[model samples]
Target chain A: MRDPFRSICDDDLERRWIWISLILAFAMGGLLGLYAVASNIHPPSNVETIDSSRLHLTEEFAEDKLGVKQNDDGSLTVTMVAARYGFFPPVIEVPSNTPVKFRIASADVLHGVHVPFTNATAMIVPGYISEINTSFPTAGKYSFLCNEYCGLGHDSMWSRLIVVPESTQGK
Target chain B: MNYSKAASLGLANMWVAFTFFAFAALLGLYQVIERIDLIPALKSPEMYFGSVSTHGVLMGFVLTTFFVAGFGYYTATTSLKQDVWNRPLAWFGFLLSLSGVLMAAVPLLTGNASVLYTFYPPLMAHPAFYIGATLLVVGSWAWCLEMVMMLATWKKANPGETVPLAMYGTTTNAILWFITSLGVTSELLFQLIPWSLGLIDTVDVGLARTLFSWTLHAIVYFWLIPAYIVLYTLVPRAAGGMIFSDHMGRVAFIMLLVFSVPIGFHHLYMDPFHAAGWKFLHMTGTFMVAVPTLLTGFTIIASLEVAGRLRGGKGLFGWIGALPWNNPLVLAAGLALLMLTFGGFGGMINASYAMNTMVHNTQWVTGHFHLIFAGTTVIMYFAAAYYLWPKMTGNALYSTRLALTQLWLWFIGMLVLTLPWHQLGLAGQPRRISSTPYDEELVQSWLPAEFAMIAGGVILFTSALMLVFILLKTHGNSQSVENPEVEYAESLHSTQRMPHLMNSFGFWVALIVVYMVASYGYPILQFFLLDTYGTVPWSI
Candidate 1:
């Protein structure tokens, strides 16, 4: 009221709007920060990089080894290769109620995989490795598919994940 | 009036922008139909990918770049009442950019560059595409130079004068463009061109993505600034009211420049090339950028409220009704703000550190951008054209009724097109796919919403055609308006005794430089320091 020439924030409406905007921004930051902390409760975070071109020759991602492996610690690690049109071992069987880690590498180009309606998703970029960890609580067959456009045959780039009851795991 | 050069420049560039917009709208229609498998004849993967890629490139690059540059030239001349600094150099830039666009079109149309608008590596495009894209950006650099020089020249002649708000926003956009484009230009010149030309055997995909992310998000703000400029400078006057605050305009522009450039890592949230910590850091910065947009929404609305109230409006919400719906720019500003609200909400969901996984590369992402870019941003471009076209040609608009009709159609059409997209994405449909060859049963659930989207696309295409038709008819119209001088709205508050920070570019520009290095410097360097490997290109 004293000085209209100084700044517009002196106006009541402007001040209220500024406060509202700042509060919304801070609320957003806070929510994202909270998500960051909560989601990190899982032990592993993926910064792992492997030679994408040599995945087939590697001991870890060799064709024979590209499926579910029951670790001594009881967690399952699924090593897979995402090439142009398909994931290696196209089908994998895992036990429900067990934590599983997927270490996927793109043999060529860029690819993304997602098990729809679930968070088992990652971008499979060549020259780097993608690792995602989660547990399937319900026993069922999930259509795992590549969501990114890697090539012309990208539509065919899909696989199946079968999560069996933990009681039937040995069979 | 000595604005003949400015008018000619604006007309030429805007026509090019709209021409591409019309073509892209047709491709957009085809894309939706193709995606839904609505037309069996459009099932060819080659054509589908080619059309999608072209649609993205044309709308994102060709339309936005040309339109912004055109809008900026007219704004600078009109607002500052100064001659363009260098007419010959300016035209040269326009030609160079046009030639570059034409060169890139060949491969894109032929499906040889189906990598989409993103210059992602490990999947390469024809070398001509990269080279042509580089030339286009380089040519725009000439405009950037001219903008800088023009503003500097104007300031020198009148030392104490605050830069006219319209030109102020334009020059800021120019500087923003220069800084942000460097990221992608470097990626194209050093990494993509060499590989596409076969001068190199393999390219590191990580580094390529990290670099592209540098340009990815910021470029949207660059496209968006012109729209905001129209809102800040043109809309209030168009609605018959004073601007709420010119200082808020400067603050928002500076914030857009400073925060937008450094926060691009939000695009790389899912990509493993960057660390999660870096992505989170960028996510925070992403939210920071929204502050400007929020402020913008308030200021623009306040200005319109003032207009409505000044026209004898009373009570709390009565002003909204009092505002002229016949005035194309006012109606557009109202609609643009509405879409921005929807689009901005979707952006918040996408920017959340964790929620992005659900929508990343999904139809939700696609819908979000279409609303923001096509709905919120492009609608304003339409208003600017309607407002500027008549002035540029010294003719009355062919039909104000048709102009209002076109704006209404575009608004309704965009809502129809994008709202269903969020539904499809929520149902777990991915983006950029030519067809859904999923489990027939799962896809069955997606068909209804997708069919709705195709309808939306058709509406948008028709509206786009109407726009081109209206502009063309206006060009040939015999009637002329009495006053053709450009008029930006005056502020409710006096702009004198301004803060030193708000008046000058030095502090903000320097702050952006430091912010960029701090945000992007080490994340890019990590690829080299780590055991990163280059991969051979994979062509479809």
Candidate 2:
């Protein structure tokens, strides 16, 4: 039999390569994690407060309590409500480079409120409120979709965070 | 009891299933198009939802169930070295299920039932749909009963011997499905029936959802076990090698039985009816099920590696190419595993307690399932059919070239359809819809992907037609040659007998009982302990 396991016999080289790749992958993952922690520590500047009472929100509109509006102070209050399976007031607006406080609560189902762009996340449960105090450093539109399969309409339920430049808010 | 007759009956049922599947797939193509609303004429939401629902049932429920039962009957009898346990009863079950399909088809075709094939209430379907679906499930129950009885009989006759590996896996599936479907069966009989019939003016939505949740997640495993069966029992043999580990196969099956059911709460992650604690518990169970899958992956790869090495291939991983690629079973298993990586990744994301929120209802979810069910599972169905057809018909396949082409086309088409589908989901495309008329800018961006999917659909439809064509040609050609006996591949490492725990029935069943109680006991009990007002929440 002509050495049937010829390529398989060169096991040392293969083992070496596998080890190298594994080490690199772990290193990259660790660096990414560290970067996330550092960014959270030194947050952006735009901050705004949302009065929960002024909004007409129920279980259905739990996510929509915060208007994505620009303030005179160049900050944004991204209001949120956890209704049924997702955020009721999904969309929030803020001025760029402003630190924002996202006041969130649930009227019904539990929800994981995640802002992918900011790498910020929090959990919301019924009758309890949680907040993500963060800032949008850049000007762009990032969407907030219910990652939870809340119900039949879960796919269509999403809100956007529109971060505008401070110069444009007055205009 | 003759081989030819049994094979004919099996092949006929398979043909019926494939035809329904082909037509349903065509409907699916239209559904994707209609959702984009690129074609204005196809803009009826009512028609769209109806077609989508029927398409789901035909492909997911009817096709898989019928193929499994028919194939199981033949494989069982032949592999066991005996006739079917009860030929008449099997036929009766077949007929009952077929009748139910036709009855359900009436409402589905007429657009009278558009409840999206889910057991969720408040969105109710016609009474006929429930009754028909019930009959179909009831019919499969008969097949399950036969499987258990046949296995028991075989054990009794062959004292102090291990059941054939193939037969063992099939019996495990039979057992798994019976236990799994009970959740849906209870819901349909007691809840959906009464609500649809107007016997109950207002049913408990939370209770009904909980009951539905029980079946929602596990049923996928019921669909999946047959695929895993093909992988463990058929794939190795097809590859010109023996199974790497029989113990691994047993463990995987046991895990599937124990874990597939209790993890239903992962589907209820977003439901208001369930508490976070219960959902979290089920999430843990969901992750636990991944153990068997990882085991399956290792065992299968090792088996393939052994085969490759045996074939005189050299270099680490170079043995991969030495294994037979021309064989349909080998080809399919390869493709199925490749899809499993991506499908399994999506499943992990879905199973992740927190990460699920990002991909919940997006095209990602749709893309994930299609990869698993259509990409992984259906390819195995194709491979099994190809391998078995010549044996069944006592004639060679009309064209192995066409068979190879069909499989290739299927793999390519699935990639074309699903790759963009994932992007479209990330781009925020909702799944169940009649039109994407809103957000023109957004819809325009989706246009290219939708177009690619259409092309993919065309290729798939053509491939499906070719599949039916080859089977039909094989059936018609009259070559009076004797069919070769179905041969299982010998293992690379062979043994005469195994331990009782690995080979015995009693130990495994006890293990299943203990596993189910530990996994599901607390999660289910929590619903009862926590108080809810008027209607009692249905417990799985």
Superposed by TM-score, candidate 2 places the C-alpha of residue B22 at a distance from the truth, in angstroms, of 0.9
The local distance difference test score of each candidate is 0.87, 0.69
**DockQ of the two-chain complex in candidate 1:** 0.56
Give the distance in Å from residue B259's predicted Cα in candidate 2 to where it truly belongs.
1.6
Alpha-carbon error at B422 in model 1, in Å? 0.8
Which lDDT tens digits does candidate 2 get at residues B233-280?
A: 778877878777665676677777777777787765544445455665
Q: What is the C-alpha lDDT profile of model 1 across B242-273, one tens digit per residue?
A: 89999999989988999998998777777767
Write candidate 2's Cα lDDT for A80-127 as tens digits.
675553455555667776767666654433344445435344544333
List TM-scores for all candidates, in order. Answer: 0.97, 0.80
Q: What is the Å distance of residue B472 in model 1 from its true position?
A: 0.6
Clashing pairs in 1: none
Candidate 1's clash total is 0
Over 4 Å off, model 1 = A1-8, A39-45, A165-171
